[model samples]
Target: AISRWPNRVDQRELRQSEIYKQGMQTRRRVLGDTHVNAAEVQKSSFDAPFQELITEAAWGHVWSRHNWTLRERSIVTIALLAALGHLDEVAMHVRAARNTGATREDISEALLHTAIYAGVPAANSAIKVVKNVFAQLDASGE
Candidate 1:
């Protein structure tokens, strides 16, 4: 099948676009320099396009929007990831929550809502992920 995305030249232009720059900033802010740096270090040609797509679309377009604060987006993202059984991402966002100013109470409350709406198993699994992440954070004194 024909690819629907732009050609390589256009994709190169997009990498230099203002939105991509904004996304990188927002991504680094939310995920932290350590995590973003590790991800960048691990980036390879195979997944480079995927990374850029998410950086531009998710971070730049949705996350960088002014309608909600970073905390709000962080909570929502955690809930959605949990709902979709994206437990690894749930853990990631839970760690990012600290940077977004989301407290443990806020995350607990969000998980409560996730339990009611997304189901018990999903929320339960996510809560476990959160606990592990929290333990790591506490140990690191972060």
Candidate 2:
């Protein structure tokens, strides 16, 4: 098979790259220290590569972009996750939305769009998740 690029970078080297470092910073900023610390504590050799991939690609390459504010990205991410029936991820992002400057109203509007574009069921489920997370946040005074 023909390859697009002959060279393949090693995972170890990629982890040490500047983008990875930037991604880690962005991830911690967005997800918060507690979430990142819990994830790190749960990481094992089995999922190390997957963890690095998201850190470098999703966080570094995409989230780090300056064109859109984190708030905007948070709205879009919550909608997409809701649309895809990823209720767990929707909850996680909903929690992260606070740090991204996305208000509860923004999330509600995004879910409305999700209901129209994705499906009623998906949006309903996401709404439940959002409510639960919001309750937790409120209880914690976060």
Itemize residue pairs with steric clashes in candidate 1.
none
Cα misplacement distance, residue 30 of candidate 1 (Å): 0.5
Q: Supply the global lDDT for candidate 2.
A: 0.95
**Model 2 Cα lDDT, one tens digit per residue, 48-108:** 9999989999999999999999999999999999999998999999999989999999999
Q: Residue-pair clashes per candidate, as listed?
A: 0, 0
Per-residue CA lDDT of model 1 for 15-100, tens digit only, reads: 36799899999999999999999999999989989999899899999999999999999999999999999999999999999899
Indicate the residue-level lDDT of 86 in model 2: 94
Top lDDT model: 2
Q: What value does the lDDT take at residue 76 in candidate 2?
A: 100
